[model samples]
Target: MRKKRRQRTILWCAIAAAIIIALLWTEQIALLYVLATLGLTILMLIVAFADLEGAKRSGQATDD
Candidate 1:
């Protein structure tokens, strides 16, 4: 279901953030790349969730 997918997305994002922080703590320059990638991914997820919520609202309105 959509809820499950959303939860998984959030979980993965958290995991990614944790990994990036760990790498950063170790003074790894590679963490910069990971941070950039994760930032873009989080942004995309936000957009997708916004769109999904809008669609769900419209669908519910139509059903009434």
Candidate 2:
């Protein structure tokens, strides 16, 4: 499950990088605000997933 979360995060980051690259290649300066919003959203998701994984680990440890 933790591996799944990490894979998801990596997938999202790769997708974002591709999108940013495409946008920059196309010279779409007007859409930078949109990109910024997307970047922040991805960042938040990463942090959330990390926290969840950490909590799971701690929970499991306590269960033992």
Query: Which residue runs of candidate 1 sit more than 4 Å off their true CA positions?
Result: 31-64
Local distance difference test, candidate 1? 0.84
Q: Estimate each model's TM-score.
A: 0.47, 0.54
True-vs-predicted CA distance for residue 22, candidate 2, Å: 0.3
Best by TM-score: 2
Task: Give residue 5's error in model 2 in angstroms.
Answer: 0.4
| Per-residue lDDT of 43 in model 2 | 97
Cα lDDT listed for each candidate: 0.84, 0.85
Every candidate's CA RMSD? 5.9, 6.1
lDDT of 1 at 15: 90
lDDT of 2 at 50: 79
lDDT of 1 by residue, 1-64 (tens): 9999999999999997887788789888776887788889999999877878777787784553
